[model samples]
Target: MKSWLWLLVGLWPAFASGNDEAAELLKRVRAQHSADVVVSRYEIEIVRTEWQRTVIMAVTEDQRGGRYQGMVIAPRRLADTLYLKRDGRLWMVIPRLRRKVGISPAMLSEPWMGSDLSNQDILQGDAVIDDYQHRVIARDGDLVTIESTPLPGRPALWRRLRQQVRRDAVPVRVDYFDQDDVLQRRIEFSEVGEVGERRLPMVWRIVPMPEKGEYTLLKVSGVEFDPTLPDDAFNALEQATAGTATSP
Candidate 1:
Protein backbone atom coordinates (compact mmCIF):
# COMPACT_ATOMS: atom_id res chain seq x y z
CA MET A 1 0.00 0.00 0.00
CA LYS A 2 2.91 2.37 0.73
CA SER A 3 4.38 1.77 -2.73
CA TRP A 4 0.99 2.49 -4.33
CA LEU A 5 0.71 5.69 -2.30
CA TRP A 6 4.19 6.81 -3.39
CA LEU A 7 3.38 6.22 -7.05
CA LEU A 8 0.20 8.28 -6.80
CA VAL A 9 2.05 11.12 -5.05
CA GLY A 10 4.67 11.24 -7.78
CA LEU A 11 2.05 11.31 -10.53
CA TRP A 12 0.22 14.21 -8.91
CA PRO A 13 3.09 16.66 -9.54
CA ALA A 14 3.33 15.63 -13.18
CA PHE A 15 -0.29 16.64 -13.62
CA ALA A 16 0.20 19.74 -11.43
CA SER A 17 3.44 21.59 -10.45
CA GLY A 18 5.94 24.45 -11.14
CA ASN A 19 8.07 23.29 -14.05
CA ASP A 20 5.10 21.35 -15.29
CA GLU A 21 2.89 24.43 -15.21
CA ALA A 22 4.93 26.35 -17.77
CA ALA A 23 5.25 23.26 -19.91
CA GLU A 24 1.52 22.72 -19.84
CA LEU A 25 0.86 26.35 -20.74
CA LEU A 26 3.17 26.13 -23.68
CA LYS A 27 1.45 22.98 -24.82
CA ARG A 28 -1.96 24.53 -24.45
CA VAL A 29 -0.99 27.63 -26.43
CA ARG A 30 0.44 25.50 -29.19
CA ALA A 31 -2.59 23.24 -29.33
CA GLN A 32 -5.20 25.95 -29.02
CA HIS A 33 -4.02 27.77 -32.16
CA SER A 34 -3.05 24.76 -34.19
CA ALA A 35 -5.99 25.07 -36.53
CA ASP A 36 -5.93 28.86 -36.67
CA VAL A 37 -3.10 30.66 -38.45
CA VAL A 38 -2.18 34.19 -39.43
CA VAL A 39 -1.69 35.28 -43.07
CA SER A 40 -0.69 38.62 -44.48
CA ARG A 41 0.32 40.42 -47.64
CA TYR A 42 3.46 42.52 -47.45
CA GLU A 43 5.27 45.04 -49.63
CA ILE A 44 9.01 44.44 -49.22
CA GLU A 45 11.47 47.18 -50.08
CA ILE A 46 15.15 46.33 -49.78
CA VAL A 47 17.44 49.30 -50.36
CA ARG A 48 20.90 47.78 -50.79
CA THR A 49 21.94 49.79 -53.82
CA GLU A 50 21.21 53.09 -55.55
CA TRP A 51 18.41 51.43 -57.55
CA GLN A 52 15.79 50.52 -54.97
CA ARG A 53 13.33 47.85 -56.02
CA THR A 54 10.03 46.74 -54.55
CA VAL A 55 8.57 43.27 -54.14
CA ILE A 56 5.22 41.94 -53.07
CA MET A 57 5.04 38.99 -50.74
CA ALA A 58 2.31 36.81 -49.33
CA VAL A 59 3.11 35.08 -46.07
CA THR A 60 1.57 32.69 -43.58
CA GLU A 61 2.81 32.01 -40.03
CA ASP A 62 1.48 29.64 -37.43
CA GLN A 63 1.82 30.27 -33.71
CA ARG A 64 4.00 27.67 -32.00
CA GLY A 65 3.45 25.47 -34.99
CA GLY A 66 5.39 24.28 -38.01
CA ARG A 67 4.97 25.61 -41.56
CA TYR A 68 5.70 28.99 -43.17
CA GLN A 69 5.47 29.89 -46.87
CA GLY A 70 6.31 33.10 -48.65
CA MET A 71 5.50 34.01 -52.25
CA VAL A 72 7.85 36.73 -53.49
CA ILE A 73 6.91 38.77 -56.58
CA ALA A 74 9.40 40.84 -58.50
CA PRO A 75 7.67 43.57 -60.47
CA ARG A 76 8.37 43.54 -64.23
CA ARG A 77 11.04 40.94 -63.66
CA LEU A 78 11.91 37.47 -64.88
CA ALA A 79 9.60 35.35 -62.79
CA ASP A 80 7.66 35.28 -59.55
CA THR A 81 9.32 33.35 -56.75
CA LEU A 82 7.70 30.93 -54.37
CA TYR A 83 9.03 29.65 -51.07
CA LEU A 84 7.00 26.81 -49.68
CA LYS A 85 7.08 24.50 -46.65
CA ARG A 86 5.25 21.31 -47.33
CA ASP A 87 5.57 18.43 -44.85
CA GLY A 88 8.80 19.94 -43.45
CA ARG A 89 10.30 20.19 -46.92
CA LEU A 90 11.35 23.65 -48.11
CA TRP A 91 11.24 24.37 -51.83
CA MET A 92 11.66 27.34 -54.09
CA VAL A 93 9.49 27.81 -57.18
CA ILE A 94 10.20 29.91 -60.24
CA PRO A 95 7.31 30.82 -62.51
CA ARG A 96 9.32 30.61 -65.71
CA LEU A 97 10.39 27.04 -65.09
CA ARG A 98 7.24 25.84 -63.37
CA ARG A 99 9.52 23.54 -61.40
CA LYS A 100 10.26 23.52 -57.70
CA VAL A 101 13.89 23.38 -56.60
CA GLY A 102 14.70 21.90 -53.21
CA ILE A 103 16.54 24.19 -50.87
CA SER A 104 19.51 22.27 -49.48
CA PRO A 105 20.53 22.27 -45.85
CA ALA A 106 23.79 23.98 -46.85
CA MET A 107 22.06 27.03 -48.31
CA LEU A 108 20.75 27.83 -44.88
CA SER A 109 23.99 29.56 -43.96
CA GLU A 110 23.92 31.76 -47.05
CA PRO A 111 22.79 35.36 -46.63
CA TRP A 112 19.25 36.15 -47.77
CA MET A 113 18.81 39.13 -50.09
CA GLY A 114 22.38 40.16 -49.34
CA SER A 115 21.33 40.90 -45.77
CA ASP A 116 22.31 39.47 -42.41
CA LEU A 117 19.20 37.33 -42.52
CA SER A 118 19.35 33.86 -43.97
CA ASN A 119 16.78 31.33 -45.11
CA GLN A 120 17.56 29.23 -42.08
CA ASP A 121 17.04 32.22 -39.86
CA ILE A 122 13.46 32.57 -41.05
CA LEU A 123 12.81 28.85 -40.63
CA GLN A 124 14.43 28.61 -37.21
CA GLY A 125 11.40 29.94 -35.35
CA ASP A 126 9.61 26.69 -35.99
CA ALA A 127 10.27 23.56 -33.91
CA VAL A 128 11.21 25.39 -30.73
CA ILE A 129 11.02 22.10 -28.86
CA ASP A 130 13.69 20.61 -31.12
CA ASP A 131 16.04 23.56 -30.54
CA TYR A 132 15.83 24.69 -26.93
CA GLN A 133 15.47 23.20 -23.47
CA HIS A 134 13.19 25.55 -21.61
CA ARG A 135 13.32 26.94 -18.07
CA VAL A 136 11.27 29.69 -16.52
CA ILE A 137 13.83 32.27 -15.41
CA ALA A 138 11.97 35.28 -14.02
CA ARG A 139 8.91 37.53 -14.10
CA ASP A 140 9.01 41.28 -14.64
CA GLY A 141 6.03 43.56 -15.32
CA ASP A 142 3.69 41.03 -16.76
CA LEU A 143 6.59 39.63 -18.76
CA VAL A 144 8.43 36.38 -18.13
CA THR A 145 11.84 35.36 -19.41
CA ILE A 146 12.35 31.75 -20.32
CA GLU A 147 15.96 30.82 -20.75
CA SER A 148 16.37 28.11 -23.36
CA THR A 149 19.47 25.97 -23.70
CA PRO A 150 20.08 24.56 -27.13
CA LEU A 151 19.70 20.83 -27.26
CA PRO A 152 22.74 18.77 -28.28
CA GLY A 153 20.78 17.05 -31.04
CA ARG A 154 20.06 20.29 -32.93
CA PRO A 155 21.40 20.07 -36.49
CA ALA A 156 22.17 23.78 -36.74
CA LEU A 157 24.90 25.53 -34.79
CA TRP A 158 23.11 27.61 -32.17
CA ARG A 159 24.20 28.00 -28.58
CA ARG A 160 21.02 29.21 -26.83
CA LEU A 161 17.73 31.02 -27.28
CA ARG A 162 15.98 33.15 -24.68
CA GLN A 163 12.34 33.98 -25.28
CA GLN A 164 10.28 36.63 -23.53
CA VAL A 165 6.64 35.99 -22.75
CA ARG A 166 3.98 38.53 -22.12
CA ARG A 167 2.04 38.73 -18.86
CA ASP A 168 -0.61 36.62 -20.48
CA ALA A 169 2.05 34.13 -21.58
CA VAL A 170 2.68 34.85 -25.25
CA PRO A 171 6.14 34.84 -26.79
CA VAL A 172 7.36 38.36 -27.67
CA ARG A 173 11.13 38.35 -28.01
CA VAL A 174 13.45 35.61 -29.24
CA ASP A 175 17.23 35.99 -28.95
CA TYR A 176 19.74 33.64 -30.60
CA PHE A 177 23.28 32.64 -29.73
CA ASP A 178 26.23 31.24 -31.63
CA GLN A 179 28.01 27.94 -31.06
CA ASP A 180 30.65 29.79 -29.08
CA ASP A 181 27.88 31.08 -26.80
CA VAL A 182 28.10 34.54 -28.29
CA LEU A 183 25.00 36.61 -28.99
CA GLN A 184 24.31 36.45 -32.71
CA ARG A 185 20.80 37.67 -33.34
CA ARG A 186 18.06 39.45 -31.42
CA ILE A 187 14.47 39.33 -32.77
CA GLU A 188 12.24 42.08 -31.44
CA PHE A 189 8.46 41.95 -31.63
CA SER A 190 6.27 45.03 -31.60
CA GLU A 191 2.70 46.17 -32.32
CA VAL A 192 1.58 42.93 -30.80
CA GLY A 193 -2.11 42.38 -30.65
CA GLU A 194 -4.86 39.85 -31.20
CA VAL A 195 -5.39 38.05 -34.50
CA GLY A 196 -8.71 36.38 -34.01
CA GLU A 197 -8.26 36.26 -30.21
CA ARG A 198 -4.69 34.93 -30.46
CA ARG A 199 -1.93 37.39 -29.56
CA LEU A 200 0.85 37.64 -32.14
CA PRO A 201 3.92 39.56 -33.18
CA MET A 202 3.20 42.01 -36.01
CA VAL A 203 6.58 43.64 -36.55
CA TRP A 204 9.97 41.93 -36.32
CA ARG A 205 13.53 43.26 -36.30
CA ILE A 206 16.50 40.96 -36.77
CA VAL A 207 19.50 42.66 -35.19
CA PRO A 208 23.06 42.35 -36.45
CA MET A 209 25.57 39.87 -35.09
CA PRO A 210 28.64 41.25 -33.33
CA GLU A 211 31.19 42.52 -35.90
CA LYS A 212 28.41 42.26 -38.50
CA GLY A 213 27.29 45.79 -39.19
CA GLU A 214 23.75 46.54 -40.40
CA TYR A 215 20.64 44.39 -39.75
CA THR A 216 17.41 43.22 -41.33
CA LEU A 217 13.95 44.39 -40.39
CA LEU A 218 10.79 42.54 -41.38
CA LYS A 219 7.65 44.56 -40.93
CA VAL A 220 4.31 42.81 -41.21
CA SER A 221 1.82 45.44 -42.17
CA GLY A 222 -1.85 44.98 -43.08
CA VAL A 223 -2.10 41.64 -41.39
CA GLU A 224 -5.29 39.60 -41.79
CA PHE A 225 -5.73 36.14 -40.43
CA ASP A 226 -7.66 33.28 -42.06
CA PRO A 227 -8.33 34.90 -45.37
CA THR A 228 -9.78 33.53 -48.59
CA LEU A 229 -6.40 32.80 -50.16
CA PRO A 230 -7.00 30.21 -52.82
CA ASP A 231 -4.55 27.52 -53.79
CA ASP A 232 -4.84 28.73 -57.36
CA ALA A 233 -3.16 31.95 -56.35
CA PHE A 234 0.00 29.88 -55.99
CA ASN A 235 -0.29 28.52 -59.51
CA ALA A 236 2.71 29.17 -61.76
CA LEU A 237 0.70 29.79 -64.93
CA GLU A 238 -0.95 32.75 -63.29
CA GLN A 239 2.46 34.28 -62.76
CA ALA A 240 3.38 33.86 -66.41
CA THR A 241 0.13 35.40 -67.63
CA ALA A 242 0.62 38.36 -65.33
CA GLY A 243 3.89 39.07 -67.14
CA THR A 244 5.79 38.69 -63.87
CA ALA A 245 7.76 35.66 -65.02
CA THR A 246 9.46 34.30 -68.16
CA SER A 247 9.41 30.82 -69.66
CA PRO A 248 11.53 28.34 -67.74
Candidate 2:
Protein backbone atom coordinates (compact mmCIF):
# COMPACT_ATOMS: atom_id res chain seq x y z
CA MET A 1 0.00 0.00 0.00
CA LYS A 2 2.98 2.28 0.15
CA SER A 3 4.29 3.25 -3.25
CA TRP A 4 4.35 6.74 -4.66
CA LEU A 5 7.11 7.52 -7.11
CA TRP A 6 7.38 10.27 -9.75
CA LEU A 7 8.74 13.61 -8.62
CA LEU A 8 10.18 16.24 -10.92
CA VAL A 9 10.85 19.84 -9.94
CA GLY A 10 10.19 21.78 -13.18
CA LEU A 11 11.87 23.52 -16.16
CA TRP A 12 14.23 20.78 -17.31
CA PRO A 13 14.63 17.17 -16.39
CA ALA A 14 14.62 15.35 -19.74
CA PHE A 15 13.52 11.96 -18.48
CA ALA A 16 12.83 9.04 -20.80
CA SER A 17 10.78 5.88 -21.25
CA GLY A 18 7.32 5.96 -22.78
CA ASN A 19 4.96 3.21 -23.83
CA ASP A 20 2.81 1.19 -21.45
CA GLU A 21 0.71 4.31 -21.30
CA ALA A 22 3.51 5.99 -19.44
CA ALA A 23 3.53 3.19 -17.01
CA GLU A 24 -0.14 3.47 -16.32
CA LEU A 25 0.13 7.20 -15.98
CA LEU A 26 2.89 6.74 -13.44
CA LYS A 27 0.68 4.47 -11.47
CA ARG A 28 -2.12 6.97 -11.18
CA VAL A 29 0.19 9.74 -10.08
CA ARG A 30 1.79 7.60 -7.44
CA ALA A 31 -1.48 6.38 -6.08
CA GLN A 32 -3.33 9.68 -5.74
CA HIS A 33 -0.45 11.87 -4.62
CA SER A 34 1.38 12.31 -1.31
CA ALA A 35 4.81 13.79 -0.89
CA ASP A 36 3.64 15.88 1.95
CA VAL A 37 1.82 19.23 1.71
CA VAL A 38 -0.22 21.31 4.06
CA VAL A 39 -1.97 24.57 3.53
CA SER A 40 -4.25 26.41 5.88
CA ARG A 41 -4.82 29.69 4.09
CA TYR A 42 -4.42 30.27 0.40
CA GLU A 43 -4.75 33.25 -1.92
CA ILE A 44 -2.44 34.01 -4.78
CA GLU A 45 -3.02 36.41 -7.64
CA ILE A 46 -0.12 37.53 -9.74
CA VAL A 47 -0.76 38.98 -13.15
CA ARG A 48 1.89 41.09 -14.77
CA THR A 49 1.00 41.38 -18.44
CA GLU A 50 -2.37 39.84 -18.95
CA TRP A 51 -4.64 42.33 -17.25
CA GLN A 52 -3.69 44.05 -14.05
CA ARG A 53 -0.28 45.63 -14.39
CA THR A 54 1.21 44.21 -11.20
CA VAL A 55 -0.66 42.55 -8.41
CA ILE A 56 0.98 40.00 -6.09
CA MET A 57 -0.81 38.92 -3.01
CA ALA A 58 -0.06 35.71 -1.15
CA VAL A 59 -0.96 34.36 2.24
CA THR A 60 0.17 30.82 2.72
CA GLU A 61 1.04 28.17 5.28
CA ASP A 62 2.74 24.93 4.48
CA GLN A 63 3.92 22.04 6.63
CA ARG A 64 4.89 18.98 4.76
CA GLY A 65 8.52 18.15 5.32
CA GLY A 66 8.21 21.18 7.57
CA ARG A 67 7.71 24.92 7.04
CA TYR A 68 6.58 27.46 4.42
CA GLN A 69 4.92 30.67 5.41
CA GLY A 70 4.23 33.56 3.06
CA MET A 71 3.02 37.11 2.94
CA VAL A 72 3.63 39.05 -0.20
CA ILE A 73 1.50 41.99 -1.23
CA ALA A 74 2.81 44.21 -3.92
CA PRO A 75 2.20 47.78 -5.02
CA ARG A 76 5.46 49.05 -3.65
CA ARG A 77 7.35 46.67 -1.39
CA LEU A 78 5.61 44.68 1.30
CA ALA A 79 7.08 41.29 1.95
CA ASP A 80 7.00 39.27 5.11
CA THR A 81 8.01 35.89 3.89
CA LEU A 82 9.43 32.88 5.63
CA TYR A 83 10.11 29.40 4.33
CA LEU A 84 11.58 26.90 6.73
CA LYS A 85 12.12 23.16 6.65
CA ARG A 86 14.41 22.20 9.49
CA ASP A 87 16.73 19.15 9.57
CA GLY A 88 17.08 19.23 5.81
CA ARG A 89 17.48 22.98 5.97
CA LEU A 90 15.89 25.67 3.77
CA TRP A 91 15.11 28.97 5.39
CA MET A 92 14.12 32.43 4.27
CA VAL A 93 12.43 35.28 6.06
CA ILE A 94 12.57 38.86 4.97
CA PRO A 95 10.59 41.57 6.67
CA ARG A 96 12.09 44.52 4.85
CA LEU A 97 15.13 44.53 7.11
CA ARG A 98 14.64 41.57 9.36
CA ARG A 99 16.62 38.78 7.74
CA LYS A 100 16.74 35.01 7.33
CA VAL A 101 17.36 34.27 3.67
CA GLY A 102 19.33 31.27 2.60
CA ILE A 103 17.73 29.23 -0.06
CA SER A 104 20.40 27.90 -2.36
CA PRO A 105 20.44 25.18 -4.98
CA ALA A 106 21.34 28.09 -7.17
CA MET A 107 18.20 29.87 -6.12
CA LEU A 108 16.30 27.33 -8.22
CA SER A 109 16.53 29.79 -11.12
CA GLU A 110 15.31 32.91 -9.46
CA PRO A 111 12.47 35.17 -10.68
CA TRP A 112 9.45 34.66 -8.51
CA MET A 113 7.97 38.14 -8.94
CA GLY A 114 9.52 39.03 -12.26
CA SER A 115 7.57 35.91 -13.17
CA ASP A 116 7.98 32.17 -13.63
CA LEU A 117 8.03 31.54 -9.90
CA SER A 118 10.98 29.25 -9.32
CA ASN A 119 12.54 27.99 -6.10
CA GLN A 120 11.93 24.74 -7.87
CA ASP A 121 8.54 26.12 -8.79
CA ILE A 122 7.53 26.48 -5.19
CA LEU A 123 9.18 23.29 -4.06
CA GLN A 124 7.50 20.82 -6.42
CA GLY A 125 6.36 17.87 -4.33
CA ASP A 126 9.46 18.04 -2.15
CA ALA A 127 11.49 14.84 -2.50
CA VAL A 128 12.27 14.88 -6.22
CA ILE A 129 13.85 11.52 -6.87
CA ASP A 130 17.22 12.75 -8.08
CA ASP A 131 15.62 15.78 -9.80
CA TYR A 132 13.67 14.11 -12.65
CA GLN A 133 13.30 11.33 -15.12
CA HIS A 134 9.88 10.23 -16.31
CA ARG A 135 8.39 8.92 -19.53
CA VAL A 136 4.98 8.61 -21.22
CA ILE A 137 4.51 11.01 -24.08
CA ALA A 138 0.93 11.16 -25.25
CA ARG A 139 -2.70 10.89 -24.26
CA ASP A 140 -5.37 13.54 -24.65
CA GLY A 141 -8.74 13.34 -22.94
CA ASP A 142 -7.52 13.03 -19.40
CA LEU A 143 -4.09 14.33 -20.28
CA VAL A 144 -0.80 12.65 -19.26
CA THR A 145 1.99 14.08 -21.34
CA ILE A 146 5.08 13.56 -19.27
CA GLU A 147 8.70 14.18 -20.28
CA SER A 148 11.43 15.39 -17.96
CA THR A 149 15.19 15.81 -18.39
CA PRO A 150 18.18 16.43 -16.17
CA LEU A 151 20.20 14.10 -13.99
CA PRO A 152 23.79 14.32 -15.10
CA GLY A 153 25.23 17.46 -13.63
CA ARG A 154 21.86 19.05 -13.15
CA PRO A 155 21.77 22.84 -13.39
CA ALA A 156 18.48 22.84 -15.19
CA LEU A 157 16.23 25.55 -16.49
CA TRP A 158 13.94 24.10 -19.13
CA ARG A 159 15.47 21.43 -21.26
CA ARG A 160 12.20 19.59 -21.26
CA LEU A 161 8.89 19.61 -19.46
CA ARG A 162 5.81 18.83 -21.51
CA GLN A 163 3.80 17.53 -18.62
CA GLN A 164 0.02 17.73 -18.74
CA VAL A 165 -0.94 15.25 -16.10
CA ARG A 166 -4.40 14.26 -14.85
CA ARG A 167 -5.33 10.65 -15.00
CA ASP A 168 -8.06 11.24 -12.46
CA ALA A 169 -5.96 12.95 -9.80
CA VAL A 170 -5.76 16.33 -11.58
CA PRO A 171 -3.82 19.57 -11.18
CA VAL A 172 -1.16 19.89 -13.89
CA ARG A 173 -0.32 21.35 -17.28
CA VAL A 174 3.23 22.20 -18.06
CA ASP A 175 5.33 23.18 -21.07
CA TYR A 176 8.64 24.88 -20.66
CA PHE A 177 11.60 24.28 -22.87
CA ASP A 178 14.96 25.80 -23.44
CA GLN A 179 18.46 24.61 -24.28
CA ASP A 180 17.47 25.01 -27.94
CA ASP A 181 14.11 23.33 -27.53
CA VAL A 182 12.53 26.80 -27.66
CA LEU A 183 9.05 27.06 -26.11
CA GLN A 184 9.85 29.19 -23.10
CA ARG A 185 6.88 28.60 -20.89
CA ARG A 186 3.17 27.85 -20.81
CA ILE A 187 1.76 26.33 -17.65
CA GLU A 188 -1.98 26.70 -17.47
CA PHE A 189 -4.17 24.79 -15.07
CA SER A 190 -7.28 26.49 -13.90
CA GLU A 191 -9.24 25.57 -10.81
CA VAL A 192 -8.54 21.88 -10.43
CA GLY A 193 -10.41 19.90 -7.81
CA GLU A 194 -9.61 18.48 -4.34
CA VAL A 195 -7.40 20.31 -1.90
CA GLY A 196 -7.76 18.64 1.42
CA GLU A 197 -6.53 15.21 0.58
CA ARG A 198 -4.45 16.60 -2.26
CA ARG A 199 -4.99 16.98 -6.05
CA LEU A 200 -3.91 20.59 -6.01
CA PRO A 201 -3.17 23.34 -8.54
CA MET A 202 -6.06 25.74 -8.14
CA VAL A 203 -4.97 27.97 -11.02
CA TRP A 204 -1.76 29.02 -12.69
CA ARG A 205 -1.16 30.69 -16.02
CA ILE A 206 2.42 31.49 -16.84
CA VAL A 207 2.98 32.23 -20.49
CA PRO A 208 6.32 33.90 -20.75
CA MET A 209 7.06 33.29 -24.40
CA PRO A 210 3.75 32.47 -25.95
CA GLU A 211 2.63 35.85 -27.34
CA LYS A 212 5.96 37.39 -26.37
CA GLY A 213 4.71 40.21 -24.20
CA GLU A 214 5.99 38.50 -21.08
CA TYR A 215 3.37 36.82 -18.95
CA THR A 216 2.79 35.57 -15.45
CA LEU A 217 -0.65 34.88 -14.12
CA LEU A 218 -1.13 32.80 -11.01
CA LYS A 219 -4.39 32.27 -9.26
CA VAL A 220 -5.13 30.03 -6.30
CA SER A 221 -8.19 31.62 -4.83
CA GLY A 222 -8.93 29.64 -1.67
CA VAL A 223 -7.55 26.23 -0.80
CA GLU A 224 -7.62 24.54 2.57
CA PHE A 225 -5.46 21.59 3.44
CA ASP A 226 -4.55 20.45 6.92
CA PRO A 227 -6.22 23.51 8.45
CA THR A 228 -5.39 24.37 12.06
CA LEU A 229 -2.09 26.12 11.32
CA PRO A 230 -0.73 27.47 14.54
CA ASP A 231 2.81 26.76 15.55
CA ASP A 232 3.35 30.23 16.62
CA ALA A 233 1.96 30.92 13.15
CA PHE A 234 5.47 30.11 11.99
CA ASN A 235 7.77 31.62 14.57
CA ALA A 236 9.86 34.76 14.38
CA LEU A 237 6.76 36.34 15.73
CA GLU A 238 4.96 35.31 12.58
CA GLN A 239 7.80 36.94 10.76
CA ALA A 240 6.96 40.00 12.74
CA THR A 241 3.27 39.44 12.30
CA ALA A 242 3.91 39.17 8.60
CA GLY A 243 4.84 42.79 8.53
CA THR A 244 1.41 43.99 9.55
CA ALA A 245 -0.90 41.73 7.53
CA THR A 246 -2.87 43.10 4.56
CA SER A 247 -4.74 41.97 1.48
CA PRO A 248 -7.83 39.85 1.88
Give TM per candidate: 0.70, 0.29
Model 2 agreement with the true structure over 153-245: per-residue lDDT tens digits: 755655776777777745376777888999877777776657546565555677777666555665555544445656565566344334432
How far in Å is the alpha carbon of 191 misplaced in model 1? 1.5
Evaluate model 2: give its TM-score.
0.29
Over 4 Å off in model 2, which ranges? 1-67, 70-99, 102-120, 123-160, 167-176, 182-226, 240-248
- Point to the candidate with the largest TM-score: 1
lDDT of 1 by residue, 2-120 (tens): 01111111111112223655555455444323444456665544444345445567666443244456667557563357766544545667666676666677777777555556655
lDDT of each: 0.53, 0.53
Model 1 regions lying over 4 Å from their true place: 1-18, 24-38, 44-55, 60-68, 74-79, 97-99, 122-124, 152-156, 211-213, 228-248
